[model samples]
Target: MKEDLALMERALTELHPGLYRYNTKEEFARKIADFEAKLNEPLREDRFFLLTAQLLSGIKCGHTYLNPYNQKKEIFERLIGRQTYIPFHFRFIDGFFVITENASEFDLPKGSAITSINGRTVDEIVQGLVSVSTADGDGTTLTRLRSVDLSRENGASYAHFDLYFPIFFPLDRPEFEIEAISYRSKEKVRLKVPAMTKQERTAAMEKKYGKTPGYDEGWSFKFLKDGTGYLKIDNFITWKLSIDYKRFLADSFSRLKEAGATDLIIDIRNSDGGDAGVVTELLRYLHKDPFSCETGIRTFIRTAKADPELLKYASVYDQDLKAALLNGVPKDRYKPAKNGLLEFLNGAVACPETEPYADRFDGDVYLLTGPDNASAAFTLAKRVKEASLATLVGRSTGGNLNGFNGGSYLFFNLPNSGFEFDIPVFAYHPADSSQAKDSGIEPDVNAISTASDAGEAFDRTLDKTLRLIKEKQAR
Candidate 1:
């Protein structure tokens, strides 16, 4: 236990200084001690690792995490079979749990209330879990707490929580009971529903989403006859595909122009973040550039210090040096891009990519965003807003947008039982700062997804965009 704590502390204080800077050493040490004291029992080798996984959840940085080293990969593979995931999508609205989607087996109706999980009230579980959630967005704390891989944090046998609700039983030989309550009447009812295996639920999810054309990976596009394009980008994991992606995007724009397309809808709901290069490449398709947003060197220095490896190279321009430089640089030097992550950097400034998009699409663009819209996606949205090329339509993005660079990890085994920890170093920030860093981009048009709006074949935001496009065409 001491060894594990020591390693964790080292990872925070020495290996990953970013994790330590906000809190004083004595304060952080006390926090660690408090955390250790909270554990009810001594951890087993495997369980220790699971706890470590839970620890990463507390940091709130989207990119930092530890993976299993040693036999953990094999253990993880083996463990995958023993556990099951509760396959349901939910959101928090008005401080109440609302069901957005569920498998037929669960039969939990849309707009149904989720009163409790495993005898614990929804609020209790959320408070316990959200502090460690990587999910970004408004109710993100709650959504992530309930919607994440719970089985990993707790044990596999108990990984699946028993959800109780009032409703008709979806099947016989029930795995769990359903209890429902009327919002107005305040009456409760109960029924038993059979639970679907995690694999079955996963298969259903895949089959359901797999039907969408071009749903393969990374950035995929679909075109509508009315000059509206639906483009879904998965992540910015690599820049090697940027040229190919740009070519395909250019081709799609040519086709849209030929077909008299009037608008573009860029869907960035599920993306967390990736290389800024992807955003830079996408800029090639826009017709105009945006106003400049200066990101001072303080932000850059902190970002550089976040990663020990980055600090190795960036130490020369530490906080003091970077601050001095920012003071000396001309204010007019920086500019915000259509994607802030793609902002151009000068010799001394750390900025988003400044790559120009092909000057092909001059029409209005509609961006479908959500809390899950994060990192690079937020950067892109910021740039688009600045350029006046697109109006964001949807919820505020998950506000944890930090300038991100690729990360590296280290593996360590717990001394007593051989539990392992993974650490990430090397956090980077864009040189420009037109948009707020921690707070995400706010949508120009407030488009929200409601529990009542699910499975309606039409989306309110899509409808709104369609109407706007028609209005523009009429003009």
Candidate 2:
């Protein structure tokens, strides 16, 4: 156990570029030592995973953590593949656990407030879960957003809450003792709901809501009654998907132009980010001038070769790492920079300024941002705000504007327990580094959604944006 802990410490210190970006070396060492102390006795795989997750969360990089999906089949089955999940969908709204979808046989309806689960208060469970959940810097938007997001658009087999809640707060029985306040009558009631396996929960959801669009069909465009074009992009991961995103944007904008629409709303509130190239393509149709996606991609390690000890338990996902290990990191690709960091020279540098698309929309633009907006989506929001390309309406976004760790990754598997954790190899920084590293992109117009909004299927952010546009047009 101690040997594994030492190896993890070494891997993070030697390979992780942004290891100290949010925490000091001394603080990190202290954390490692604390965890090491806990290793005096052997721990079960689940307990070890919980401690490792909590330790990794201190890194404050959203891309870092033990990914449940990446775990081996046996490890996954032992840790997460069980029938111990809350039998309902809920979101944390204004510190309340509001039911968004009820899957249990109980009479609890949507918008009902769940004050407690199994014997723990909602607040206690949330705090415990947040401690182990990964997020960028100190922001909790992504953590909160992920807690209730059951959408399979991101290709996850299970919800975040379903995967983590049981591990963090294990239940001895196969049922959840739920105490909820009714949404319609405001009456408090307690019920013992049977726990559900991933398959059961998925089957229930399908039976209740039917089939929804897959990730490939996550993008759509339509015109509002007021002649406003609404372009909704749920994700930017078009590289591997069947969707031709560039053509989609081009056609959507062309339609808007032909309709003579002078206002456009690009909704990315549900986006958790994807290919930056996709983001750049979308910007060409909205941004007036050429803009670079990032200043540069930086990494602490110059060589892609992994330490043999760590490499034994690690797997390479991208070809870059594989090629580097076989031959070498192409000399022309990276150069040593100041602060002992290696900077990718070719495509990793600030992208060259490409002129806006010939048919770029030259009308009022508004972007809908929210807690789920992250990665390349966050990059879009930052670029739009930095260049004054659009009016950001909604809550603060998930990713930090200062910079984030991504571009490349290193997947590590703990030798003792087959738990897998991801570490982003490179860190991408914005041109302006003055922004707070721990904060997210604040919206120009704040419009928070309530449990009632979710229950009624109303979009408060979009409504506020339309009203704001209407008021501006009235002038």
lDDT for each of the candidates?
Answer: 0.51, 0.78
lDDT string for model 1 (68-135, tens) is 22334555444443223344555554444555555546456656656654355666655544544554
Alpha-carbon TM-score of each model against the true structure = 0.69, 0.92
lDDT of prediction 1: 0.51
Model 2: colliding residue pairs? none
Clash count for candidate 2 is 0
> In model 1, how many backbone clashes occur?
21
Q: Considering every candidate listed, which one attains the maximal lDDT?
A: 2
In lDDT terms, how accurate is model 2?
A: 0.78
